[model samples]
Target: MSRTLQSGYHRPRMLRHVGRFSPVRIQSMHYQSGRHIRLLLQPGRSLYDALVRPLQAIGVTSASTTILGGHFDHLEYCVAPPDPSGKAVIAYSSPIDAGASFMVFGNATLGKDMEGRPLVHCHASVRVEDGSVKGGHIVPQASIIGATPISVLVTALEGFELRQAFDDETNIPLLKPFKES
Candidate 1:
């Protein structure tokens, strides 16, 4: 904890994870020149499909995306809190239904899962119908887009693939870039 001498205010320390720390903290990859796409997320489609299908058609399977603000018919998200079990440092909580929410801003990553399926990892700040603002990991498959199209900026990763692999330190499947075999 840290204390302010004059004000006598004590600040709690940041929580540490229970798992063994990995030597490689940031597993990132870069490309020579990213292919940028200004995509308009089609209405009436799940966020997952809206992102995956069109990009797949363009041969872009790996990329980082920024989802601009837009409305959703329904939305569900999960927050990461301390794991109740001692298996990992943190775990995603059960999905929280944010009914008829407006996504204020979001960043999403596109990669291939262990089974070679498209996986979208998205986090967003949203405004619910009740006017409360919240943020968490967005469930793209469950969140349906509203009538209007949502704008997204996509930076396609090429020359290498983003694949999910098991990480020993975190004991989780994480997306990492790998050169084409």
Candidate 2:
């Protein structure tokens, strides 16, 4: 409907995967309610352990968490770019270190990996040790919390679970909601 389209100009090629597109793009499930918890990421713990251990202790296996602004002794992140191998639409790049970073903001999801292990997928904007501001997918396992505890608000999903499974449409493993098993 834009001037380009109305003028019959061809659009540029869209970013897409090589796999067959699935009809169900938005996968969803219902839950009666969610438990809210105020979690503190203890200092010196890996972001993954800090986020996963406490939640796991409380019987929360799946959640959406808001990570409050704070600092980290070390941080690493990865950007997603076009896959050279063409195995999927895009792939995460190798971890990039953002040393002694200050997390401006972040959000994370706790789920189970394809192998049924805990997975913490997080994205954040941070000010690195060099004072440059950047944002990308945070590498929780490698990032260490700073001296002070960082707070997080957790909304624990009930009656269902989030699990990573292979998606044919994008030819990647993705987290999706499924009935509790």
| Per-model TM-score versus the true fold | 0.89, 0.92
Error of 1 at 25 (Å): 3.1
The collision pairs in model 2 are none
Model 1 scores a C-alpha lDDT of: 0.91
Stretches of candidate 1 off by over 4 Å are 1-21
In the range 35-64, model 2's lDDT, one tens digit per residue, is 999999999999999999999998999999
**Which clashing pairs does model 1 show?**
none
The true-versus-predicted C-alpha distance at residue 95 of model 2, in Å, is: 0.6
Residues 1-181, candidate 1, lDDT per residue (tens digit)? 3544777668867645545667877766677888999999999999999999999999989999999999999999999987788777788999999999999999999999999999999999999878899999999999999999999999999989888998777777888999854
Error of 1 at 34 (Å): 0.7
